[model samples]
Target: MHRNQGLYNYLNEHSWQITEDWYKLVNDEDSESIYSTTDPEIIQSLKEQNQDYFQHLHKLFIEKEEDFFRDFKIWSEELAKDQKHLKTPVQYVVREFMNSQEVYMKYLKEYFSLNKDNVALDQFLSWIDLVRRVVNLSIYIYIEEANRNTLRQLIAQKEIINELSSPVILLRKKIALLPLIGDIDTARAKIILENTLSQCADLRIEDLCIDLSGVAIIDTMVAHEIFHLIQALKLIGVRSTLCGIRPEIAQTAIQLGLDFSHIRTTATLSQALDRIIAD
Candidate 1:
């Protein structure tokens, strides 16, 4: 109540103008309230009170923003624990909220105690609604990424699932070492191709080493798809050298009568690295 009296004083002093939010808080609702009904003595007192309110509220926000995040981190964690166990970064939460272009005109009006005017309040309310939507979208992104990561883990758990090596860089070159861990279908192969190609442009990578030591088998169609990826990379100025081909996988290539068709094949990553270095 005292704080309100202080804010009222401050608003009255400025003719209801809110400087920070550019809102004429005092004059926004009614100038008559201060000068028409109230005496000059009462108006003078209100000004003094509002000055105190401004100082206190400014201090409060400075203190509270830090605490709000700390509390939010704790609260979000608690909420996540009771849910399906999806944990997201608090950084994401705060960033999404802070950068969210949502400014609450309504919140400003309410904070200023200009509640009687619905038209002015609507503008602020609309701003709040916009920010809320942006925050929700940001959250969705975090949740989706978390779920994708979980799915990737599950897939990697099966012994039959082959793990592809991440693209290793060498000699200012991108050597995509697809050391097949388990299996290679058109789908996984497509993912590997996309991942490797994505790195090529950024890294200015020249050599791509597609290793297949952990992979034991490949159908003719898969082989053709691999050939296509190499060709595509070659067209984009990325030289692909398929490395770490286990003997069994080589035999599959031979038994299936799969022609590599200009795709460079190597026995090991060491050999591939050495060759790229020599080049």
Candidate 2:
């Protein structure tokens, strides 16, 4: 007989009962948690997830420790990525895992009491150790995966914001407006340069007015990128005009020794457009 045969049988028979007990005792007061959800579908999904966890967990009694933990890792990773669990506050999720640990501890004691003659002290202690190790490791893995998901989301959002920040609007036939606003960091400037070039090509822009009136600050690197963008536009058969060059930005450009002799400049968007119409 397997060393933990009786314990395995006991857990298998009581799996549903354990899941029900866990659901009844769960604290879902946090409004951010899926556990606090009112939708019947979500609630039912939550119960099913709890039951699934128990189905994986009870195998520890019968399977080799290494095999059980390997399977548990797969299960834990899935939980970390679960749409409902991901939306839930991490604290609430971890709290439920701890609660499940408490339930396991309770059942361990009951199982021992019913079979004390056969359950040795060493075996009982080993099971306790295994339980604690699994719980701690599960929490660690969940938090690690959760952090990765958050970082992915942040990167995706930043990409969208970057695209939105550098928009090229068509002002007229074969003419377009590239309006730059806010602080121009080197990273953002690179995206602007790439996006502006792509947009000008797509719009078949001949005369491009880059408006910088809304921009509050510019560093040397950003100033360089702007010139690079204008030079890029010229290579793509687009005529470039710089408008609304603020005093601070001009000073930064001058300090960088940028040659503006060949560059077109205007004090306002209206003036730039008027110049384009006259030409």
Q: Give me the candidate number with maximum lDDT.
A: 2
Alpha-carbon shift of residue 152 in model 1 (angstroms)? 11
Structural similarity to truth (TM-score) of each candidate: 0.41, 0.93
| Model 2 weakest lDDT span, ten residues long | 1-10
List model 2 lDDT by residue over 1-279, tens digit each. Answer: 224988988988988888888888776777888888778887788888888887787888888888888989988887778877777778988898899899888898899989999988888988888988989988898889888889999999999999999999998899889899898887898899899989989889899999989888766666678889988898999888989988887887788776677888999999999999899
Write out the backbone clash pairs for model 2. Answer: none
On the 0 to 100 scale, the lDDT of residue 177 in model 2 is: 93
Tens-place lDDT per residue, model 1, 1-279, is: 112333334334543233323222232123323312245675555444434333333232233444534544444344333222233344433342343222233333455465444334554454355335434543555565556666766877732332234454444435544454566677777776776677776777777777777776688877877787888888899888888877887788888898875677677888888887788
In candidate 1, how many clashes are counted? 19
Candidate 1 Cα errors over 4 Å, as ranges: 1-176
Alpha-carbon lDDT, every model: 0.53, 0.86
